[model samples]
Target: MSPLTTSSRRRILFVGEAVTLAHVVRPVVLARALDPARYEAVLACDGRYLKLFGELPFAWRPIETIPTVKFLDNLAKGRPVYTAETLRAYVRDDLALIEAVQPDLVVGDFRISLGVSARVAGVPYFTITNAYWGPYSQLPFPLPEHPMTKVFGVGVSQALFNLARPLVFALHTLPLNRVRREYGFPSLGTDLREIYTHADQVLYADIPGFIPTAPLPPHHCWLGPVLWSPEIKPPDWWDAVPEGRPIIYVALGSSGENERALPIILQGLADLPVTVIAATAGQPLGIKPPVNAYVADFLPGAEAAARAALVICNGGSLATQQALAAGAPVLGIASNMDQHLNMLCLERAGVGARLRVGPLTAKQVRKMTERLLGDAGCRQAAGRLRETLRDWDTGQVFAARIAIQGGDGQTTATQP
Candidate 1:
């Protein structure tokens, strides 16, 4: 493929790994937010969440992604999610897509194969990722729940984890490095951070200063949070949710073990002087909803979050950002490392609290919910953070980056 000339609008391709909804949603949202006149956007991903997006302005192409069950199981077992052979297959598919789309630049959210595919195709690549995964992150890594954590207590497991985390991270980088070596590229080194961020440009979908990091490379910059919500309509009970009491919105998301957690959440808040609105993410709710709680399979997250006095979720960036975007305090019931890392930042920012899923209890949820709902400080912090998020035009920043990369060298892109 020839280089794109200045006279033509740049064609940008976005590839999202469909292992989780957040991965697919981030890229789709960014693609939707682009300046159509200056950029031709194409999105390629598995069709798991496409129904939620409704009609799109840009072109959509189908692609293969590993099963979500396999991905989550790997995370739970502390195993690397991808294998050398799996990534090798992904590279072939990505290259085929690159040939078909012929994009001037490629943007990926958790589509790790692009690290090898884009480079081999001689295309510039940009990655959308959280700051906590970057090399410069100053936040501590809490040991995720693994077999070791269950065998040994958290205290002992955490200590062992601290001692072995470096080795474990290196091991996780092997599959990607092996694929890179096959493509005649040098190893991205043993650091998983470097492997994940290996691209021509890296965009962090997070608030500035919310997570401390060292000085970033010029190509690495904040694009702010790419906030997106499903297009699902509110349940019939939405209007009927009582107005006088505090409203607590609950959505544990897909990555965590929601089956066990949802019951605890409902039980904890059963007698509280609040209204509970929970989204079950389409999973069957084995137990009945409490009198004060309303249950649904899906909810428009942004609107649901905006109306809540408190937001509870899986502690992943997408849900937490949704709550913080609405100026609502959060109580994260986190299970995975990604969730833990994200929740750590929110906790440090004083806008939220994090509780592990392993030992979650009704009493703990009630205590945390009462504390967050009653504490003026949590709401105040969330309000301030909401203002900060408002100042960051994520779409404009991303468009400006594309403009500069396409030789326009502009700080902002004009939108229609």
Candidate 2:
């Protein structure tokens, strides 16, 4: 088909889970990058994300599917937990949606079940995930901890993960593989481990600074971070931010991590000579901010980063990338594996520092924040990295690649 042919306006389906805003926001930005004349996009997600995509220029399809396993509870209990029924339900719903839409291409943002459905439907599919999930993850860095937890924690964790890997695979594949067999779709292979490898493309939604490029399978593409801008109006007090002191933007994403960390952050910033903009995100901690702090339920991250001197966050990729884009240094207090990895990248890139959750203290957070704000070198380094990232123009680069790939229906070789 020619690039300008009617078939070039390929119908695309995007599936996202509303467990977090990252999944919703990333796809919206990519959907916006496609030319209206060249793509007809439809989004499928839970009801919570309905309003999120309502403002976007695309068809919205609501699917009642719970997308994530409750890993947080499992982690806290130091046990492996699997939600088999949830996975099956999601697969069923997603397959129904695929049958209805009949999209030429389907894209999933962190929703692996959607990829399975697309495969069953014989349609090409893509997924956006962190590169750390790939074999390139380097973690378990040295740190002071309880002697027992320090000496045995890593080994125990690794052992448990290895032991549970097959069980986890079976929990998901039992249902999906059964459906594939019933439909005469080729069984995903003898060892069901390959079930996770269904996508035609696996786009790593992280920037180079976070996950440096390395040799990988041909199906993988490091698409950098997807930059998103929300349309929410800033609070009236936004214009009243104090002057002469550096402005620090503090947010813990939208999943209530702020509830635990916000008060500590407030206590840390109490005596500092800086203006703190804390995003409560409608999850209050019952602590009022000090004199130099401005607290809001929500603020558009891009707008806040544009005026920030520094950013304090839970090391979410979206927040960190937005701050880096605005040339702001970061002080990340990470509470999860992914957050820890992203913070490591920021520190290596000379744009930020990290405080792991186990041993984290208000004093250490304050010290790091103050040091980052006071150091001229940190700001200069962040500015340089920001310039380099701007040169990448991540959205435009990915958009052009999509256009090229969709110009003809023929599948091309995937990027490594």
lDDT value for model 2: 0.70
Quantify all predictions' global Cα lDDT against the true fold: 0.89, 0.70
Candidate 1 residue 348 Cα shift, in angstroms, is: 0.5
The most accurate candidate by TM-score is: 1
Q: For residues 269-332, could you state the per-residue lDDT of candidate 2 as single tens digits?
A: 8898888887887787678778888888778788898889998887878788888889999888
Off-target runs (Cα >4 Å) in candidate 1 are: 408-416
Poorest lDDT segment (10 consecutive residues) of candidate 2: 139-148
For model 1, residues 350-379, the per-residue Cα lDDT tens digits are: 999988899899999999999999889999
* Candidate 1 residue-wise lDDT at 315: 95
> Which ten residues in a row are the worst by lDDT in model 1?
407-416
Cα deviation of 166, candidate 1, in Å: 0.7
- Please give the TM-score that candidate 1 achieves against the real structure: 0.97
**Per-prediction TM-score, please?**
0.97, 0.84
The number of the candidate with the highest lDDT is 1
